[model samples]
Target: MSQALEQVVAELRNSLGTIGEIVGISESATPRFELFHAPNSICSQKVRAVLAHHNIPYRSHQLNIFEGQTYLPANVRLRLMGCIALGGGLVTEHTGSTSVSMGGCDPAVVPTLVDWETGQVLVDSKRICFYIDQTAADGAALRPAHLQNAIDAEVAFVDNMPNYQMLAGKPPGEDHRPESRRKGNGVGFAMSKVERCDHYLAQFADDADLVRGYSAKRSKELNAAQQLFTPEAMRAAYDKAEAGCNHLENKLKSGDDWVVGDNVTMADLYWGVELLRMKNMAVESFWANGAKPAVAAFVDKVESIPAIRASVIEWPGAMY
Candidate 1:
């Protein structure tokens, strides 16, 4: 293992305690698959289930996002230092450093999969899950041939649910500002207290200017959320999650154990992960109260599979 990976494993053990040898455990010398993910991430859960179902082993890198570990210089590099000249004889300059002492992975999202054999690095969960299933030579097949497009469409619908935006800040909406500011603006006023304290700020303690700038940037997001994320929006988010559950309930009413067909498929994996998020968020009553009887039974049936069971991880922020 690299020294950097060793440090991450140590840090995770220190904070999470007895989580077992998770990060840094290599399944092979030249691992074809290496995954960096947070256990609680819904995307991560889906990817894990796909891997488990195929019995594909991977080297794991655990990232705790709430701590800002995902943004750590050791994990994600920021190339912010530059000089820009305005048309009106004005020059904006950065002093001293070429960059903020750069290092870390790019596209710093959780559940990043590095496939050494193919030299491909995948970021999106749906893409990764599809890739794995497609490449698998032998395994429980996850996609029914004719239903692929429908499954992909259903997955996208669940993915766009407003509750997901609520979990972070808010769902994306059109804004004239920069992307971060746009995200902040759409976010509701309420904030989920982070599972871990912000450690990213500490890395810049020696640079007062950087600290101030970063803090101000985050403050703008909070302010925007307060203005945009209102009570009506929050209720709408809840309703959206309920709607996702209702969709699943309707699918299950067909009396099949799976979401799309007789066998497990991408649609089942997609909804399985989404429902897991609902369970973690404490709003599963949307399922319990609104969904039909078959919905719960379907969940019970899917989660009972050895692959799915092995894929389950404890969410640090789960309400229950």
Candidate 2:
């Protein structure tokens, strides 16, 4: 941990009595749900968006990847280290770590959801969104029978593509280099990317600016793995995304207020957050950037909704 984060952890422990445990452990008897995530992670954003739409209260635990806190507890750390070795080298190391204790053994990525009551922890963003949709107090049925498969396919697509974009933008040899090459390189490289992106984002001064900056930097970095952001490639990706957006635009145009159905279902929340990411990436879209009248109208419509608007708006320093 950096001196800064170490200090933050120390102060938190002093204030809350334990380093890793939730704050105000005695506050209420209500079942608590905790989301472990990084601030600018898209998957994390998706989960938060759903929580906001469903009005499900949750505790947010910010994990610092640089500090290796994501692999806390000795066994998980070693297992992660071993996986890094077996994947033909450091390319695998760059992948995130997720242990069963943290919920599952898969994605090991952020936006992990833990239901404190049932001790059920789910890792994938889509699955967690479904859980919230089916279980939250305000859970309204949003996926129509005709559109369920389509919406599910879209969510799955969104879940996987952002990570590919992130990996594609990195310096060559950085992601797939040998572990020896990264002995002291991982944290520094990650932090430097963070700084550069922050610098670019300094131009914007509003909450939207922060969101845009963070999302843009992340998209750029994830796209580094391929190291090729040629216009053709970007356009191709944008074109595919545009199709998804149009599907949504048509849905909205059909007199339904949201993408999946009449209500703001998990489908709406999922696509809404994903579109926010695409918008930040400056992907050409007919609806969002005034490129398409119907699409732009749909963007306006969703943003006008109180819950959806509130969910996408950034809260910089607020914990949780």
Candidate 3:
């Protein structure tokens, strides 16, 4: 980690319990890992599912991303550092999911992991999930040696689903999310992000990186603020998500219990979150209308796992 990242982590650790709501397996002394996450985020759910699945012990530093928790000064710095470390001064554009995929990184997001024992700060849900799996207790991992390639492809397929953008803006002339969720977080995140960006732009006027970071976030938010009426953009995202549904349906038609096989792997964990997010988005028409029976059953099966239930389904306001 860079000196800046280490310093930010140090500052964040000082305000842990006060600013963040703690959950997960609490250890008396310092836990081996500390997670900074938001329950509303799909990425956070993915990492939480991995940890819960393997029964790994860690401290959960929960944030309210919709309330601008991720846009707070310290979090902005932490996420900014992670982005810069990934070889970017700041996030200049959006292509796919903010925290995953081959498109680009979102400078402001949640579910950052601090591996205290190893002095490592992990970013990105996909990377974090794999890291947790490989370093699992007794070195036990989810992916079988021979199935590694297949499982990785499945994971990547889930990563490509535009869950973030879907929530940021829904389909034009039609909202598929359940009525209960229509009044949820994603609708106002752009506004929250704007407030934080403006505040930091004035407060961190002298810090070039911080200023640029906040400014970049503000620019993205401004674009998203107008995205609500943009049929083209929303339709494009919907098409992508629709494709994901079709892909999963095809994969599950082979009579597999999980994404890759009967046993759960990193792929299964990721798809669990992705599938649930899709369902909650109320986009199930693609697979729920007696068309993709296998996909529907697989979604229920994935959620049936103890870890997924406790980590995702039970998480209050976890998905928008």
Best by lDDT: 3
RMSD of each: 10.7, 12.5, 2.9
TM-score of each: 0.65, 0.58, 0.87
Global lDDT for candidate 2? 0.49
Superior by lDDT: candidate 1 or candidate 3? 3
lDDT of candidate 2 over 173-281, digit per residue (tens)? 3344233333432334444554544553454435452334244334534433333344444345445556666666666667765665566665666666666555554
Residue 103 lDDT in candidate 3: 44
Q: Which prediction has more favorable TM-score, 2 or 3? A: 3
Once fitted onto the true fold, the runs of candidate 3 whose alpha carbons sit more than 4 angstroms away are 1-7, 13-28, 99-101, 180-192, 223-229
lDDT of 3 by residue, 90-183 (tens): 5544554654445455666787887877767777788888888888874547777888999999887787777666775656556777665466
Model 1 ranges with Cα > 4 A deviation: 1-27, 77-108, 163-228, 289-291, 313-320
lDDT tens digits, residues 1-320, model 1?
A: 34544454345444534333333234656456767677766667778888877877776666775555544443321111110110121112211111111111122235666666764556556667888999887856687578777777776666565543445433323222224324442343223211111344566767653444344334434443554356565556666667777787888887665777777777877777667656655555565753467777777776666655666643343222
lDDT of each: 0.54, 0.49, 0.74
In model 2, which runs have C-alpha deviations exceeding 4 angstroms?
Answer: 1-30, 64-108, 142-147, 160-235, 284-290, 317-320
Who is ahead in TM-score, 1 or 3? 3
